[model samples]
Target chain A: MSADQEQRTIRCLVAKVGLDGHDRGAHVISRAFRDAGFEVIYSGLHRAPEEIVQATVQEDVDVLGISILSGAHDTLVPEIIDGLEEYDAFEDTLILVGGIIPDDDEAELKELGVSEVFGPGASMEQMVEYVRENVPEKE
Target chain B: MSDLIDELLAGKHRALARVITKIEDRRSGHRDLVSQLHQHTGNADVIGVTGSPGSGKSTLVDKMAATYRDRGLTVGVIAIDPSSPFTGGAVLGDRIRMGSNIGDMDVFFRSMSARGSLGGLSTATTDAVKALDAFGKDKIIIETVGAGQNEIDIVKTADTVMVLVPPGSGDDVQMLKAGILEIGDIFVVNKADLDGANRTVQELREMLDYSDGAILQSSGHHGAGSMEGTDGLQIEAESEGWDPEIIETIAQRGEGVDEVLDTLDSHATYLDDSGERERQARTRYAEEIRTLVREDVNDLMAEELDHRGGMDAYLDDVVTRETDPYTVADELVGPLADCVRDRRKE
Candidate 1:
């Protein structure tokens, strides 16, 4: 690929926010992004809501994937939205959540500004395509 | 473009981040961004921290950055991890250890993967450092993946390098003896709470002493007249009139790390007073120019090859022994020579 095409590549940050220590999904998705020719930043495990927002903004990631398996999705997802709002990044950034989120909490999460939620058995290809389709084109 | 450059120089955080992404991706216009921002750099002191795996290098960097932050200095950290060769993926875990400083606006932390680079850093690491430098960071710490003899390229770009020696890792001592000693401006005995902490310190001090003693012993006996047979040992020449210091630290506990920062400050002062700062700057600039020239040549070669069928034809010739590889290389170089001259004219 041309260097210019490589530079215009999508940038994604896969994060584990709040007390959710489980990161197998985060790792799998992050590697998928990179293998799919995107620049992926894995923020490791056990990140706070503010830290997630700060990392997302500073890294200028087009898509922010929060993997929370701790069942605190309702509490933590809102905090992440508030963080994005506080930083005035909500309009520009696309948010996605992946974890063992209960089916009942899915609608509220989307209501809380999460664009999509991938529960158990979500395929890597599906998530990758979702992000690729969602983020806006580069200027 | 100039407006974006102006925003970046004015410390627009988002602009700085965008430029870094562009550079890291090797995107078009990255050269313009770098060339324009180049003059705005040199204000930030770049420090490199490298050690072996499980050497507590990340923790040390975290503590040292906190120390700099306490002194009201803005810190930018670039922590690198090796890419998975099989998967082209990496889990850059340094930011996890440095989670405590996540909320601090003064601190900007980015995790990087080596991206198949043989060296201990990404190809864009220095450019990223330049971005951070232009963003007004007072200090930029590049924490490289714990590397061995061949991956010390961080030494070339850093104003001062801190080589961490974890206690109880006897192999690190041996590695230092092999060649890593030359790159260090400061030696840190990390995890001092562990056993062999004192022993590690003693071993490092002994290594430094022996090397220094050997140089002097040879110089005195030969009256500084002969450059041959200095105990059959060739020491990497360092800046004259400066001694590398050794500090002991337990980074996880936040113990003894302040002294490491203090020693780094002293090293910076030494570089300024001894004129080594200018020398280091010149070395980095020269390296950047050489790399750009090489890239330009590669671009011309690629264009020529694409126009002439492709690599398959050349490889088919080599495979069938129809033509020699050297001849093919010469044919390729024949077109590149003029293109290089034209580039110089431009």
Candidate 2:
């Protein structure tokens, strides 16, 4: 990485959408991002797609990590993506999905614009490295 | 840069966010950006809410923002969280409690980290407030990183400062007697639905009454009284005769939020009527100037050290007792002092 890129702090937003009160995974990932020297904003549980998108745009974060174990990623992730596109935030934000996902749905989610998905037992190091490699360069 | 400012002034949320980023990072030309924003400020009523951890500051602020929005006022919120002193990273979770204003574009909420600021607020916070103010937000709320006695810098930013006290913590009330009591324009007993809420309120009221009497007695004596205000701004506000209000709130259920809003409105009127607002602004501007100059001089001193073959060159001499720290400081600053003296003579 260039010196400038290394110096620029990556801002990430880890959000739990749609009534999934189970936030242990979200808290763990947020800590992981902080340890990796990135500023992470955790959107507390039971957020709507529109709320997540609004936060993403207003925060101007580099990465959007949506943690959903409620098995509703198919319905919610697309709406989040659509909201981001509507606000012109999709192009700059690299989206990552964590929690349960069927293999078929994972591919379709990626087709919609998710950069990566982490299933259960994914290493913290792996998620951090993926973000370092994939986050879009800030202008 | 001008284009970015134009976009921000045109009420674009993305541009405002980007400008705030520039301010937070201290990117080149940020000072210029903020300077240009000065003319557009002074319109928004800035309210600062601070308390201890889990004191329901976020929940109360969320409800307050929603209340203001319901009243047809545009709102902007800047919630501060502490940065990890080791890694300079932060997990800002204040947005979670702010679910009330979620899909509303009129209510803009952004989170900030302390970024190694010991005062619990970095200079970026003041500048970010300016950015939001310049963007035409009617009400701007600054939620501090849970405050301790020394973390009273919120007084320098907000028009009216509200300190939240959780119910049943008599020790918490005593803790406030140190620094926060003098700065708070209003004290809120949040989580009023909890046990011992009434007792907490009574303790707070007693404390405020004691402080009020102390301030009144001190002002009358001018310089002879023990409770003479340490902060000039506080003295000005006290002399204006605006007593701090203590109110109870159940923030989680949005109860007592309207009363909080009413208190804020009355405080605003008091500031305007008493001319304390103008006095506070003057003091704030003076402090801002001093802070900026201090930072610039520190940067220059660092560069001067580097130019003198780094601190190692001086360190060895000091370590061997060949030169004392005072002597080294004098040697390093001598040239700059002489240059300034020479300019005065010219």
Candidate 3:
């Protein structure tokens, strides 16, 4: 994986997983990522676990960012991570989560293979940098 | 729209209900479905109804819902009950009084607990509304568990907000929370069947007078003949044991729902037809976006800062009075606020 390969168009798919419909941030992030030159595909409100995994595979995304505000993150995120692992996309895709996460759950999410867990108030600058620096590029 | 959404868009009842349920379910892969729905939204009107617990909002909401249903319109209802602190979700579906229209297959009612959300709505209520909006419900009604004035959060997402006030709830102090008055698109003197309905109406009228004469009154219960119009139309007639024509109803009995519906239509029409309505709607949309953005950004920062022990540092600073929350906000994203506002205007 190299920068030349990285420029193979950093494709990112932003999805609001589970019952959360508060997509203002998701929409904002999509535009920001688009502005930063990634091919962005946004999955809007009320998405299920399987739909997200299928979209991640179908889109062939380098990173999958899921936003959950429904307060069911503890149960929901694991389902997606486990599902992705089961589907074999878990290793290839960088999973990031944002929104109303309780303070106690960060280590658990990270242990579950989530690349980054962002809470509210993080700058778009930080987000773009984190994703760009971490996600692997094709050979 | 996708095939499933196409079916929902064409007014398939089962599809509509199922998709909304998916939108509200925490484990469902609701993202793609929502993405599909986003393309099909903007067809429905969202009306938010909220008030105090004893204000008879659900009943009034029920009546209002029925009125819309009878006119051959599809209705989507989201009922928010108080969440017990222990469980962090709605423990009771006590809003069963509004069942008159809930029985209709065309009417979809989903109940939720507030789940410690300070603003009176559960975390998922807005998402549920979006689900209803995407499902092509002609009208969406949100019945909140009346957290007094603070319940105004519903106004953040709704096009029109109806505030319910029951009779004999005490003076003006008891009728509304201090700052909550501004959130109401219209005011109702609900439970017109109770004593002192006139006094309550009078108090509301007095409050409205201060605002250049802008509030309307109605009974808050659902079913037949529940809310009759007062003779003055501008003020209560004061000779009321539930004015049969003006406001009459046993919500459980389903009386006077037709008139309440008529009042809602008239108010909505008034709002939509006015220049202020257009301006207000646009402002509301912007606010909705801002609230979501603010919360999302806040949560992200809170988590990151916590991980870095920044919050602990901030707490230490605050204890020593070195930095307040305002100072912290200014220090962190203060410089970026202007840019966000500018972008929002765009």
Candidate 4:
């Protein structure tokens, strides 16, 4: 592993994608990540998929979490994955989805290479443990 | 030199980024890393940009950094974002505005949480800047979270400071009047396309006129809070004047960026011509050294107290008010004073 990959600090980007004006979950999870001693960059509301990809790559975050409570997860999440690929960052970046994701859509999201899907009322502790357990080592 | 330092000196981006992370985390051995990086710094220009939250400071920084990059200068940006004390998470959205420079080999950007600090910067900001400096970035831009009285510490570290005021934000400058006026070397009326840009500029000019000879001193290179030698002091800014030029800009469209860069270059020239460059360098070194010594001494005293089991007694005395906090401090300070004297004798 490269020295950066061996780094113990887990850097994450917590973003609200789509027209989801609801950001309570994003705020909660972002704070939870930080309280867990992870370095987190909370991207403010209404960020486009391209902006999210750009932030993930530029900030060198280990995880890209999309909080879509507007029920537009399928479309926005795929676009974000595409944006990451367009930026040549898909392979190195881990994708995560949160907020209002239905049970049926979880498998599809995983097929789209999302590492995990978080539905409503999920605890911050579970999310924190998941990120710590799953964040990929840097190249 | 160790392998990581060698990689950093050879301009490896990953190594430089790792060093910055280490310093920000205060990881084990980070102090040694900072000390090693210190010798390799002093090449990059450190510029600080501060403004209220909605003043478009991020977009302004994006344009400024791009302007430098177009001149073939490598840029490293340290964007500070305030952390939520309750949750400890921060919305570091500066990268969203600076998207244009992403994926460029010549640009490096990192967003740091202020870590619950109200001071507008992370404590490790200076060390992170040094890591970038040692990594061969010609320009380092530090974009503060937002401006406030406590945020003036940026002036102590940056060579030039640009304070931004957005249009329609009336009384914004008035709120931070003295601290901002005394510290800013260049005042920018950002979002100049808005309705109140001219008004903001007028207010800033009025404040400048009202306070004459608050002119940046020769050794006042870093502005107010500078402890540097002021040998060739100019009484009036108009005499050896740098009027703290108020430039208007629509940063989103990249308008007036050249003028901003030009102002920065002129300030660089002024520092050199006024012989403030060497003096500012000395001042920065002394400040860093003194801060380090103070922290080291405090840490050593704590360790000594911990070792001798005196910490509990000290706390009990203060808690019971059996002795005042100051008196307890006085009792503990003797060991530290002796430690310093012994080191000097050695």
Candidate 1 chain A lDDT trough over 10 residues, lowest sum: A1-10
Runs of candidate 4 exceeding 4 Å displacement: A1-10, A15-39, A42-62, A66-125, A132-139, B117-123, B171-178, B213-238, B319-322, B342-346
The model with the greatest TM-score is 2
**Candidate 3: tens digits of C-alpha lDDT, residues B1-346:** 2565777777654455445444434323554676676666666778787767777777777776777777889887777655434423222233335445422556665554443434414324666677678776889888875565335665557777766666766777654445556766566666666787766666665565454443434424322232443332333234221111224334545555555565556555655655546776587667656765666577656665666577678888888998798887676675467778999999
Candidate 4: lDDT of A117?
88
Each candidate's fnat: 0.41, 0.51, 0.00, 0.21
Evaluate residue A97 in candidate 3 and report its C-alpha lDDT on the 0 to 100 scale: 93
Which of the two candidates, 1 or 3, achieves a greater TM-score against the reference?
1
Q: lDDT per model, in order?
A: 0.75, 0.83, 0.63, 0.74
lDDT of 1 by residue, B106-141 (tens): 788887666553331434788899999988999999
Off by over 4 Å in 2: A1-7, A19-22, B117-120, B171-173, B214-240
> What ranking emerges by TM-score with the best candidate at the front?
2, 1, 4, 3
- Residue A72 displacement (Å), model 1: 4.1
**Model 1 — TM-score against the truth?**
0.85
Task: Give each prediction's DockQ, rounded to 2 decimals.
Answer: 0.40, 0.45, 0.02, 0.22
> Model 2: how far is B18 from its true place, Å?
1.2
* Clashing residue pairs in candidate 2 (N, C-alpha, C atoms within 3 angstroms): none
Candidate with top DockQ is 2
Give the per-residue lDDT of model 3 (tens digit) for A8-87: 34557787776777989888887777666565656556777765665555344678999888898898888888767765
TM-score of chain A of each: 0.91, 0.94, 0.91, 0.90
What are the runs in model 3 whose C-alpha is more than 4 Å off?
A1-139, B1-7, B10-36, B117-123, B148-150, B176-180, B213-250, B306-346
Candidate 3 chain B: minimum summed lDDT over ten consecutive residues — where? B236-245
Clashing pairs in 4: B237-B241
